[model samples]
Target: MKNSPTAGYHTKSAVLFVVFNRPETTKRVFEAIRIAQPKRLYIVADGPRRDYPGDVEQCKQTRQILSLIDWDCEVKTLLREENAGCKNGVSSAINWFFEQEEEGIILEDDCLPANSFFKFCDTLLEKYRYDTRIRHITGCNLQFGKKWGDASYYFSNRTHVWGWASWRRVWNDYDVNLTKYDGTEVKAQLKNIYNDDFVADAWTNIFNELKAGKINSWAYPLDFCNFFNNGLVIIPNENLVTNIGFKAGATHTVDEESSYANIPLIEIGEITDPVFFVPQKQADLSIINRDFNIEQRRVKHNAWHRKLKRWIKSKLK
Candidate 1:
């Protein structure tokens, strides 16, 4: 539980890297990956959209950036010829990656992970490889307290979309059809997915978008699908990865709103005890409470409170 080095640090497995048209961020992410030195790497680059004026050039640049991986690993590329956007691009790429491998570590374009993050994933993958209840291994945690172990990895009801890992068997149950919720069993499951009244409206909007075909492609539903079946997500106590695509040109992250930027840096450590899945009830409760509080706090507090928090962090820094 102390800050000891992770066991089997030398053993590396396949890592699926998903990228869009951001060449600079992609370069930085690859640098982090190179240091981790995975044995097999799967690169998925989204193609350019025909309507976008500069998409062709940007897509070419993204591909060229991916070509710069200097590691001696078995590398495979899933470069799309047409733009699939975030929904389709991420979904198809992840589906394709899981189809080939039993398990893999998944990273996005802007998630620059610490070297230790790779170790955490590799260890967890080996630790929970046989546990069917544990559905995901997440690399981001907003609350970076030492209340838990050195890793502080725990099961949560909600899935974090930052950097994460999962097995193919877990992903096989993902259903994109939003209409299935009309059934009796699915409505009961929907209560668990939304967790509470405050966040249910937002989820309803997302589901509506999916139903209306407004979103050409998406993956959050798949994440929700795992949660609906009572899947567990492993989250790091320390904030090992930083997302860097809040600026313009980011497809989905255009909102200027910021929340709790203080992420603690934790050193990855070995697990003396074998990893086990957290009980289903506890996992679901943690997810429900955590998700509800986070959304409620952000919405209830005004801009002045956010600025005050920012100022406090600045002073502390």
Candidate 2:
């Protein structure tokens, strides 16, 4: 795959633009969308939260940027009157998107995507539109510097939603509350898929928060949907979307202590198909350890190592 000109490149799939109260970031993301020039654009904006002082004006300005559709495109919008927060707000917006579209690319106000990313997603969306096993098409590779397999993309069971796409068939199965996973089935499935010792505790906390309305994320439940249905996600070999909204006002990115901010987007030219269509188990495990369970695994390993060292020293004494 070599880098080429994207001058007149336009996406065949419609795009769903999710926005909120960041005009600057929205403007930049809107510029990226402008380049892709999608045929149909769906804009979803959550209203300003009452507690955030300047949210009203900021939300207004962000919506203004989102509406500057100068290119030849059909635009639809769902602008809320009151803030629904990220959990309900984003889920509801996506629900609105799939209600009209069979499949489409989804971009947040802060996800700066490379021009090539649109093509990548559009190609996969059409290719796997009917494949129930292939559930997600994402534009992120959080392996840090590690590349997986010998193809342009690899299959995994994780949900990397920095920039992604999905079909109405799969989105219809997306459960925000994951009410189906309320029993021992989640524990069994989590362990089987993730192969993590502490996946139970880690996901238990997340499910608890989701049930109690303690967190403001929709991505978590989407991950549950991916796992629950045994769906494989197609992740690019090179990163195509760079998340640029990890600043002070960000809902989750700022609070995540994440190392995934502002990654340089790589151009994925001449997309190649993988020889094997199976999910790379090692890649999936790597994502869990490096991203989800890093802190917990580190603490456990350190305590075990310390206890082992103490036992050896006492025996010698």
Candidate 3:
């Protein structure tokens, strides 16, 4: 426990902080969370890859980072025997987390969340514990609109697992293996979710990689499961967390410089009401960028280049 606030709903719930080998980022995130000082903290440290010189060193450093959490809160650690990679590592970690508690918050090593984020997650988790319709309570606001309406967050078709919290009931539905939904069955729904052709194609490629065992994953499949079950994820009006893990040892993230250049920020406002959904046709990228005052020109340009490379690769194939 770094320091306790005026005592709110956070102390009642469990918070599972998952970290891998990135000790620096892990240290910062734990430092941030330590401020909130929840009652219980579950730290899951992923094991390192074999035959890699830095693997064992990174694991040791990661453990050291976990030790930095100053809270006397029931701190538990799950150390892996062998490298399970990010997919298995996170998947196993979250599964273990849910098994311990009915509900909890999840924070990754590189994500830096605002102080209010813990309160936001805890309040929503307690409020919606019985509501099976809500699959996740996310801290990252990917698409919150300007006008504050019925709820603080809007329901998103895509599940952005940046800094999020959820219950065991919702996570129990997650299948990392993802045996359901062959290509033809969920084609239209997939198209709806990824309205942009480039984005859709990228996701398709990722799914293919997962199926072919090229890269193992659980997040994307968890997203698919959420949608399939008609479950909603509550997102904050303000972007509470920023991702700092864009360098080596990261499986998905590449091009570090371009990734963090003009990161978007969200404007926080009062969320007096709770149950709201952005209308079906209200998810315009331009409107969202304008509302948030986000300088997304660079991000759009990067997306264009990514699409171009994908297009060229497709033509070559």
Candidate 4:
């Protein structure tokens, strides 16, 4: 297995990098991967949007940065010719990743990982390759200064996909369309898991909107996929990834000023395996509550913000 979470260690598992029209962020994230120096690098890029005038140029620039691979790595690319947006673009990229790799690390243009994040996943991915209960190994920890146990990691029901690793076994059952489980019943699932009515209802509404085509996200389905299979996600005690794309152009994380934006990256120390395999119910509840509050406020505020912008533009016209 790869050495403990330390600097200057090469990553063993294949790394999948997903990019779109953000060359600046993509380059930064790519530099981190370059340091890790994974033996195999798989990149997937979504096509430029026809509606967005500069999307073609930006997408081209982002894809161009990917060809700067200088290490002795086997690199593969899946560049789309048509726009697939957030839902399809990302989920399909992951699907493409698993089609060749049994398991690997996945990062987006925005999810910048600490150098140790690669070893953290590489070691655990090998340790639990056959463990069905552990479906996810993610670098995202949203506890925000809260401590759960003495272990270096804790289990959570929430699937934080910012920078994560998973197996094909888990992805094989994934459905971005939520075809298996009825999206209307997500309230009950959340209620049972979190035991918080407000959190459950909030997530249920989000899932409902996602089903109704009002939203575009590949994460909720991934969460549901693990939830459906009674799988638990491994969250490191140290938050290893700092999401840097919480800007105006980002699809969900549009509020760059939000508290969750660009959280300080913390490299994990010696791994302390948690004794129990049960999900941290309290952590899950805290996550749902925090996420719900932030998302609800953002949605409400953004709606009004857009309307005001449109009104101002109409007056100017």
Candidate 5:
């Protein structure tokens, strides 16, 4: 893997782009991929829902944007004639991709990756291809400013799928039907892993909702599969992908002011071996706190205190 100083860094790995009716974000992400100029590019798109009034037109526009790829590359498309919803659409598209390719980078419409993201994923895809223990390599680094160690990346129990890469060996273990795991047994297993009843109960409740047909998501089930198999994800030292899909018309992201929205992207330098290949307990705990709303509450409380102080100062003036 020699870097060409003139042409810049390019990846030999296949790239999979998952898109639907969001042309605005798709254009931005596609531009980054064009710079990488992957040898093989796979486009997976879901049809517009017949019930939504303007969905069909938007979906068409999004697909039309894909025609901008003017480079000499092998392009394959999997366009659904009918809508498959988010859960089935994304999971099936990924399953189809791994069937033909051993491993590749995956990006959604809103997950805009940095130029280095492709190279980061390509390097790890080959490094851990045979190591079943490391199942996923994610471009998201949610630790804020904290670095787990001197390594360029660290292993995490949490799977961040905003922009990620993985092998067929791990994807083969994906099980959409989570009802097979008994409720009592599943709770016990998660409790052992987290060593906290509250954290385990929170995740168990979400899984129960998914099994009970209350929630529509593809990522959570993949997370469940990873944890159940004792698998780990490679998380970079700095965030490489920014999610810009928290606007209206989105399926799940309706928050106009989400904290995770528009995270800054950082270039990952040369990959270095970590001092240890283990999950950082403190960092994982930070994720759990953020997930359980504890961190959000703390942020709100601090904001309120600042507002109160400003009000008192104005009265004194």
Candidate 6:
């Protein structure tokens, strides 16, 4: 990995790398970080499950691989002794990261970011550090081939967390339980943001599932917090991060054929301000139709199958 240093800009930004039992993916992502040569690096790893055989050894190997950080930098480690699962583990790790630093770039083990991703995040983290309107700066561009404008990036309501950066102030308001707002308020807020009843209802169900303890996820709650607060995410015009952890061993991403699995990465240049700070409706709708709608349909299909199975069992009885 060759470092593409932006002119007149040194890599002073702090980076937080979240990892688990995967040493192969961690090694790849670490190479990209090595190129950037950040002054400070924070590593967070969750403890392996005691019930899963070979997990402890794999976890040990992952941490050992991270020790290959040969750059002249200060490294901090937060290794958990007990398994906290994904929802609690990741959210708590992020909370710990923000406690020490004001702002920084965050990357998961599986999200292999381009060398340019570091520069793009470093620029925007300072640019919008005080702007409450913008909450997240994401390295994902799921808009397919569409460029919102001539700017290097655009505002989006969708929270693409593959690779991202944010300030402590924005993260301070993160509620994993969605405890700040009630159901009625959340639905009304989504309705206003999308201006569509069906879309609003669909999202309301997702929040309900989160509240009902049906889904164990950390990213959805962040999206909910940002949307409820009318916060915008900065999305690069070209995708700068690729997800390479969609395999059998993965927890959430099991589908190898996912459209978002191995998206091509492009080098992002210096950050440019968009004409407007508003979320792009066209891009949002495309995401809703392509990602959200497909997931919702899959849920409904599974529900139908379960219902049919119960009916047949009752008839046989």
Off by over 4 Å in 2: 1-6, 255-258, 295-317
- Model 1 clashing residue pairs (backbone): 87-217, 87-218, 88-217, 157-287
Candidate 5 has its poorest 10 consecutive residues by lDDT at 1-10
After superposition, the stretches of candidate 6 with alpha carbons farther than 4 Å from their true spots are 1-10, 294-317
Compared to the true structure, candidate 6 yields what TM-score? Answer: 0.89
Each model's TM-score, in the order given?
Answer: 0.78, 0.90, 0.78, 0.88, 0.89, 0.89
lDDT of 1 by residue, 207-276 (tens): 6667777865466676557756777777776776777666666776654454423244456665443255
TM-score winner between candidates 1 and 4? 4
Q: What would the per-residue lDDT of candidate 2 be over residues 230-287, giving only the tens digit for each residue?
A: 8899999899999989876678788444688888888977988998878887877776
lDDT sort, best first: 6, 4, 5, 2, 3, 1
Model 4 TM-score relative to the real fold:
0.88
Candidate 2 CA-lDDT value: 0.85
How many clashing pairs does model 4 include? 0
Steric clashes per prediction: 4, 0, 1, 0, 0, 0
* Candidate that beats the other on TM-score, 2 or 3, i.e. the better one: 2
lDDT of candidates 1 onward, in order: 0.70, 0.85, 0.71, 0.87, 0.86, 0.87
What ranges in model 3 sit over 4 Å off? Answer: 1-11, 143-151, 191-205, 259-270, 278-317
Which sections of candidate 1 miss by over 4 Å?
Answer: 1-11, 144-151, 178-180, 183-187, 192-195, 200-205, 215-217, 260-265, 271-317
Error of 3 at 12 (Å): 3.4
Q: How far is candidate 6 from the true structure (C-alpha RMSD, Å)?
A: 6.2
Best by TM-score: 2
Measured with C-alpha atoms, the lDDT of residue 281 in candidate 1 is 39
